[model samples]
Target: MQTFDQVIQSNIALIQKVVDFDAKNDQLLPLDFTAANTELTDEILDDTDLFSDWVNEKLAKNNASYGIGGYNEHRTIYSRSTHFDTEEEPRRLHLGIDIWGPAGTPIYNFYDATVQSFAFNDNLGDYGATIILTYDIDGFKFNALYGHLSLASLNGLEEGKFIPAATKIAELGAKEENGSWPPHLHFQLIKDMGGLKGDYPGVCKFSEREKYLANCPDPDLILKVTFS
Candidate 1:
């Protein structure tokens, strides 16, 4: 069987760029989450609300619609826990691409799929409202995890539900509902769920990078967004 990366690469063109992101024209702004980005702003990163405000400001000032990129990025923000194991290496390697935009932004499925499962993680620094969509392409089954969506996104969602390609499955959640962070969509491609549900590790320990990367490949293969 081909790896998820192999399959995605072979089907690259078929995978649509879900978010309105184009780094070439500055439609997207790359964020350096390793620090508070205090080089340009004096805002503090410890405060999730204020930090999110700053993120939105960057997009607005740059005239960009979204803040994109961060696959396999070693982010310091994961220290918040709901997604990390602080007791260990602090899992700072971000495994997905985040599309930071206004709350209520629509989230779509890249390919036709079924709702394998969904839930509200809700823990601080967690996925908050989450959804997992499963796909079976030629017997190669995989899933996509969408995190930090509006609580209402789950209103009528049901297990085994069929969602057509590019269907608006959920809406971006505000900090109040999206795990207390700025409004954004955490989109991750998973070859294996690790027996997880609604939530999976969006970040991993440095030592486990190889294993995790093998299972959680780059989401951009589907989003097709150009990163700066």
Candidate 2:
């Protein structure tokens, strides 16, 4: 059996349909949650509204449609309560690629898949409205997680139903509905969900980077936005 990463890389055309990647009109933005920026300090990162405004301004300035990045990123923004564990090392390494865009922006299925599960994880600084889709390519089975979506996105969705490739599945959620963070889609591919439903860890501890990254490979194999 081909490895999950190999499966995606070998068939980039099928996986590339998850988002509209127009190199000409669509500009890719890389977000920095670390303290490298003199202006974006820890206090500002803690404030979602301010951070969202800052991000939006940059998008506007660049005339970009999305603010992307976060795969394997050592982010400081996880200092928020919901992302950190008191008894263990903080989960700072992000395992997903975040596409920042306006609320209600439509998200499409890259391939024919079923709605494995969906839920509203209303935690502070967490994936609020989430969806997990299962895919079977050849004999390899993998999953994808769409996080920070509108609560209503889960309405009427059932497991074992087919969602065609490029089908408009859900819209991005507003900050009020998306766990009080800036509107964005947290897209993650999982080799195995480890028997979980409706959610999976998008962030992991820096110490266990090797294991987490192996399970969650670079999403760009599918996203194909190396431009970010």
Candidate 3:
């Protein structure tokens, strides 16, 4: 059986920043929009549509990429808010590892793989532009998904394109190109999603945690980060 340990190593400098950010800002700090400007707070509450639009516009203006780590229950790493479809679900159970940085950050192919699928899931709450790559590792076949990417990455890209490990497959997109929030890369690994294509559930109900978790393991296994 192939393990992620046999795969790629992470960038140490980037990992340090993630660790440092959590330490300095209190990983459990509430997503306090109240601390922000009145205008911004009103926009977030009163006009979600306009607020989302503004976020998208800002992403286009500033090219950003992120390397934010995903949720860590033991460490108290949590999402600023909950948007799960159900109350029975884990409030902040993360479905993927977030590399939070800025848009346009170069995303490398973890290993030699062929593009299996790609799509522009443009919805209010969805992955803006996503790509899925499949490959073999130590005799085990697996898939790597790159979500919230720049639209340009999808242009001229087609299924079956051979992507070598560490190849710059795409750039982290601005909030607009990405589902509009912060610039970050949503990296996920899937064992099997059944017949699902062009769309996969990145978040799930806590009641179904075990099943979803077994299907999606910690991406840090491949990222090579020492989670605290």
Strongest candidate by TM-score: 2
What order do you get sorting by lDDT, best first? 2, 1, 3
Candidate 3's residue-wise lDDT over 1-228, tens digit each?
435544433222322121122344322211212223244554364343565454445434443222334532221222323333454544445577766554676778766788888999876446789998887765566676888889998887788888776677788887677765566677788878576766677766656678877888777766544244
Q: What alpha-carbon RMSD in Å does predicted model 2 have with respect to the real structure?
A: 1.6
Q: Against the correct fold, how does model 1 do in TM-score?
A: 0.89
lDDT of 1 by residue, 1-228 (tens): 887767777776666445554456748778877755434233445577777778878889999888885898877666654457767567888899998999988887788899989999878888889999998766679999999999999989898999888788888998888888889999998988978877788888899999999998788877766464
Instruction: Please identify model 1 stretches exceeding 4 Å from their true place.
Output: 20-26, 35-43, 80-83
Clashing residue pairs found in predicted model 2: none
- C-alpha displacement of 119 in model 2, angstroms? 0.6
Q: Where does model 3 exceed 4 Å of error?
A: 1-67, 71-83, 86-92
Candidate structures ordered by TM-score, highest first: 2, 1, 3
Candidate 2 per-residue lDDT, tens place, 1-228, comes to 677767766877676366666878789888776646567776767888897898899899999889996688888777755656647677888999999998888888988899999988888888999999999887788889999999888888998878988898888998877877889999998888899998899888889999988888787777876554
Q: What are the candidates' C-alpha RMSDs?
A: 2.5, 1.6, 7.4
Query: What TM-score against the true fold does each predicted structure earn?
Result: 0.89, 0.93, 0.68
lDDT: worst 10-residue window of model 1:
36-45
Relative to the true structure, how large is the alpha-carbon lDDT of every model?
0.81, 0.83, 0.60
Residue 108, candidate 3: how far off, in angstroms? 0.9
